[model samples]
Structure formats: structure tokens, C-alpha cells
Target: MTDKIYNVLFLCTGNSARSIIAEALLNRAGKGRFRAYSAGSQPKGEVHPYTLDLLRSLNYDISDARSKSWVEFSADGAPQMDFVFTVCDSAAAESCPIWPGHPITAHWGVPDPAAAEGSESEKRLAFADAHRMLGNRVNAFVSLPLASLDRLTTEGRVREIGRSLSEAG
Candidate 1:
């Protein structure tokens, strides 16, 4: 396997939940193989409380997690991403900045747990479900033999992972 580490970016309308969960999942699952970052087109400016709670419960380090703008990734000297995935339908529909390396992009839209309305337990369940769905997708992504695949094949595989999971349930 190649020693190179890949950079990945996850986007959403709000930087509060789904994208943040995705970032955490990929960072943990991909570990030495991939570095993950997240941002929003219209950031909420703060992460959702439940998001932090869920991650904390899962033993994830959230000390450095905060909602940020996608503009940060587009800035000069920003890390060039190998892949970019939009986890929200709204974000997928919006105009995105030109990524430095022309990274392969995909839509891995997940239902907004933050939008779930009901009892506290129900709301938390939404967050859990979102996390589970993203975990499956992230696992599929990290399993790919990226070093042996051509860029086109890698792109196709990533897109398929998103597409297949989005259709699940």
C-alpha cells in the first residue's frame, strides 16, 4: 500500500450534525489512511448539543470540534482534498467552491437529525440513526483498496458507496 494519506471533506447546509458526525466517523475509522474535515455552506456557527453528546458517549475527542465555513477549505494554503461528499440535500444543491485538486465529489445525503421534532428521546434517536447510517458508509469507504485503483475507478467506487447507502431504508 502507498504511504500517502488522503484528505476528505464533508459538507452540509449546517455544520452542526451530519457532516460533523461524518468527519468524526471517517477520522476514527480511516485513522492513518485518511484525514477528514467538515464545513457548511451556511454554518449554524455552533455544533448541536446532541451531536457533542453522542460523540462524547462514543468516546470521541470533541475538544477541537466547532462549526466552520466551507470558505476555510477554499482558502489559499488549505489542504487539497482527495474526496468531497455532501451529506445534505441542500448543500448538494448549492454552488461549491472550486477545490484545489479537483477532488472526486459525491452526495451522501442523510436525514437531518437536528430537524427531528418530538420528545427528547426521539430526537436523540434521530441522531443515533444518522450516526449509524454514516458509520456504514464510512466503513464501506475505508474498505476500498485505494492504492490499487485508478482515479476513475476510485471515484466511481466512492460515488457508489454514497448512492447505495442513500437508497438504504
Candidate 2:
């Protein structure tokens, strides 16, 4: 497994917002050591407009992002996940696919900023806050000492990272 990059999937009830944000943040931060992807158990088929707006403001490519099902990853020849995280409180409780690799999993449990019912400005703020929190956790994850620990990826260290990342979020 030399030079293998970790594949991380972010899951949510709706792939429109939180999962999208986590995907972009982790991919951007990981560069080469991590590969970030996202999907939902129940996809909305379209990303929330605000998700695109905020990501574009950050100079991220939102054009190719769309809501998709977790089943897409359950197929043959699917990219084996090294880690999986549920980014929304709803998804954390929902039934999930049996990821093939048995990759380390965790729950970040970010509230649905999309469900925030209020002024447009308030909704925007909620999205931004979720973005900030997820970004912080991803930063912590990428900086972990994965290279030094012996048989680290196979050990319980992965679970620790997941738990630590979640609590910090």
C-alpha cells in the first residue's frame, strides 16, 4: 500500500450542502494524501443553491458538483473507502450502505443549515458556520501523524481520528 492515498467519503441525508462542503474542503486540503468524495443515502438530485454560492465565493469548482446516491459507491470497482463520515445529524441515524472496505467511519453530525428557516441572510450564515466547522475538522485530520504510526491504518487509531475530528467539529 505504498503511496496509497486515503479515500474519504462524507455522507448526509441530502447531498446538497454539508456533504458537498466536506468533500470540497477535504479534497482541497488533502491535495494528494487524501481523496475526498461525498454522497447521500437519499439525494436531492440538485445541490442547494447556497452551497454553490458559498463554494464559488471560496473560488471552488461547483459546476461539477451534484447530489448523488450512496449506492453509486456500492457498485463493482468502486473506489475503496479508507474513511467514511456522516456530516449531518439526520444521516448519522439513518441506515447506511455496507461500505466494502470496512473503512473507518464516524459521525460529525453537523446540523442542516439548509433547514434553517429564516431570512436569506440567516440561512447564508448557517451554511457559512457549518463550512467553517467542517473545514476546521478536516484540517485537523489532514495534519494527523499517519505516516509515523506502525500498522496505523489497520489499528484503532483511525477510529480515534474519527472521534477526535467529530468532537472538535
Candidate 3:
């Protein structure tokens, strides 16, 4: 097998919650095989507090997590991503900058935990649910036989993973 490290970018309307959680989950679960980044069409300029709390409780490293614009990824010197996933519906619908490598893309929309309206515990539960869903999808992605599969097959698999997860809601 080739020792290729795939770069992935997760996008959302705000880079504060779903995308941020996805980035952390993939970076940890990917075991150095994948490098994950998160960004927004319109970033909130800060990672959401609840997201940070949830990640911390799960023992994930949050030092690198930050709310930034997707433009950062499109600019010169940015890493050329092999895959890109939109974690929110708004971001999936919005037009995005043309990526340099023409990376395979998918939409893995998850509910916005930060948008949950309820008591503190209830809101935290929403974050937990988002975490569970994204974790399931990311784990499925990393388990794919990416090196052996043809490009078309791999792309279809990734898209199917997204669709399956979205439908589980």
C-alpha cells in the first residue's frame, strides 16, 4: 500500500460546530492517514463554546480548532485536499471556490448543535448526538479501501456514506 496521507476539508455555514467536530474526530480517528481541516462560508470567527466543551469532554485536542473562512483553503499555499465534505445543509447548497486538485466532494449534513434551543443539558445532548453521527460517518470513511478502489467507486462510496448517515436522522 502507498504511504499516502489524504487531506480532507469539512465545510459548514459557520465553522463553529458540526465541521469543527468532524475535523477533530477525523484527525484523531484517521491515525495519521488523514489530515482534516474545517472552515465556513461565513465563519463565526470563534469555535463554539459548547463544541469546545464537548470535544474536551471526549479528550480531543482542541488547540488547533478555530473558526475560519473556506477562502483560507482556496488560497495559495493551502494544502491540496483529496476530499471535501460539507457538514451543514447551507454550506452544501452554497457555491464554493474551485479547489486546486478537484477533490472528491460529498455532503454529510448534520443538525447544528449550536442551533439547538433548550436547557443547557438538552443542548449538550444535541452536541453529543451530532458527535455520534459524524463519528459514525468518519469511521466508515476511514475504513474504506481507498487505495484499492477506483476513483469512481471511491467517490460513489463516499457519497453513499453521506446519504446513509443523513437518512439515519
Question: Which candidate wins on lDDT?
Answer: 3
lDDT of every model, 2 decimals: 0.95, 0.85, 0.96
lDDT for each residue of candidate 2 in 75-168, tens digit (9 for 90 to 100): 8998999889888878889888888978778777777889998999999999998898889778877876766755545346545554675655
RMSD of each: 0.9, 2.2, 0.8
Writing each residue's lDDT as its tens digit, candidate 3 over 19-47 gives: 99999999999999999999999999999
Candidate 2 off by > 4 Å = 150-169
List clashing residue pairs in candidate 3.
none
List ranges where model 3 is wrong by over 4 Å.
none
Task: Give the lDDT of residue 87 in candidate 2.
Answer: 86
Sorted by lDDT (best first), the order is 3, 1, 2
List TM-scores for all candidates, in order.
0.98, 0.89, 0.98
Candidate 1 per-residue lDDT, tens place, 30-54, comes to 9789999999999999999999999
Q: Count clashing residue pairs per candidate.
A: 0, 0, 0
Candidate 2: worst 10 consecutive residues by lDDT?
Answer: 150-159
What lDDT does candidate 2 reach at residue 54? 96
